[model samples]
Target: MKVIKNIIFVAIVFLISIGLLVVGNGYDMYKDAISKIPLTEKVETIKEKENYTKIEEVPEIYIKAVISVEDHRFYKHNGIDIIAIGRATINDIKAMSFVEGGSTITQQLSKNIYFTQEKKITRKIAEVFMSLEIEKNYNKDEILELYLNTSYFGEGCYTVKEASRKYFGKEPKKMTDYEAIMLAGIPNAPSVYSLTKNPELAKQRQKQVINKMIEYKYLTQSEADKILEQ
Candidate 1:
């Protein structure tokens, strides 16, 4: 019994050590990611003034679209999408590979901010913890805004606002129905659905977004059809 107790104590200590390391590394990674953002320049300059602010305010439509496509239960979940994680795990085990990831937007943001592009269990664990921290610290809108602004959407664009300008020559808030659908599609796989590279695929993705909007009652079938027609 003494030996068993010793073994359990050692295991607990090892787990605590691992958790601390993961969190420490995650903080470093988050700081690095924030530093690399171009908007950091704007943020710093603004900070010099009395009324400094962050420009990446979360838009209602943006949040709705993301939740509709990525994780419908985002508001309900703590930080992780258990169903997606389970599915990803099952697929990974079946294929003996790590190609699939069932990360929530928060998790993805956490991973992007604090973890390498590596597909490993250690990185994923860190991502989960960081996501939980993010959720705890920020409101949903703030978290969503940060995720949108920092996430890579291919075509060398890091922010939805930049992507909106590049793709539709408008800001996200002013995006037309077609433009919003197109922008929404980019997060799935930007290069493949990029209007410049694959116009047809981009159109298909836009249609998919419109369909989702329709199903979510954000738009009617007629509205979706009209947008598609345009």
Candidate 2:
């Protein structure tokens, strides 16, 4: 609960602060997400052509944990989840700030691969369209694979394979459920919840992910508790 409150506060402050720092042309940025996203931008991006990890190569627990927390309705929805957006709207009104992002996994993948992370409604709208386009072109597993292969985990690791090795010195298939949950939660806000920079925050987010897993029926209460115990 405190973690959520803190996130809301931070998001409010960050959004207000970025109002002035909203750099780059919105038009160009919109074009970016709609078109091709560069592979290595000194930051990170999902490559379209090379070294993609197959869905079978990643652990099943990782996929379930990510979908459970990030977007339970990912397989059900076309791309955007209106229910999530409505829930976020309610929370935004109650908080009097736009802290909650009701974006689905595909929408996030859209943002990561297509557009810049500018906090603007217009960019979000563009992301929605691009997300739908991606859904139309790719299957659920394909989208998940692209998302997993492309996401940026903090500590300078852009790809999940790199993140698993760099953070735990293990391959993706070798990661435990707890490790998978922790990694699953990182892409939500990489810098703030980075395990190296803020282990507590990262752990708290992991707990949230576990809670979501339970809520979504991906794991039972005992299973979740056991994972947390580890």
Q: Which candidate achieves the best lDDT against the true structure? A: 2
lDDT of 1: 0.72
Alpha carbon lDDT at 227, candidate 1:
71
lDDT of 1 by residue, 1-230 (tens): 99999999999999999988877776665555546653345334424542222344434655666777766677888889899999989999999998689988888777655567787665777677668777877677666666676666788887777777788776667776667677777878887988888989988887777677767777788867787676
User: Candidates' TM-scores?
Assistant: 0.72, 0.79
Which regions in candidate 1 have their CA more than 4 angstroms from the true location?
1-59, 215-217
Model 2, which residues run further than 4 Å from truth? Answer: 1-51
Quote model 2's TM-score.
0.79
Candidate 1 clash pair list: none
**lDDT (CA) per prediction:** 0.72, 0.81
Model 1 / residue 44 / CA error / Å:
8.1
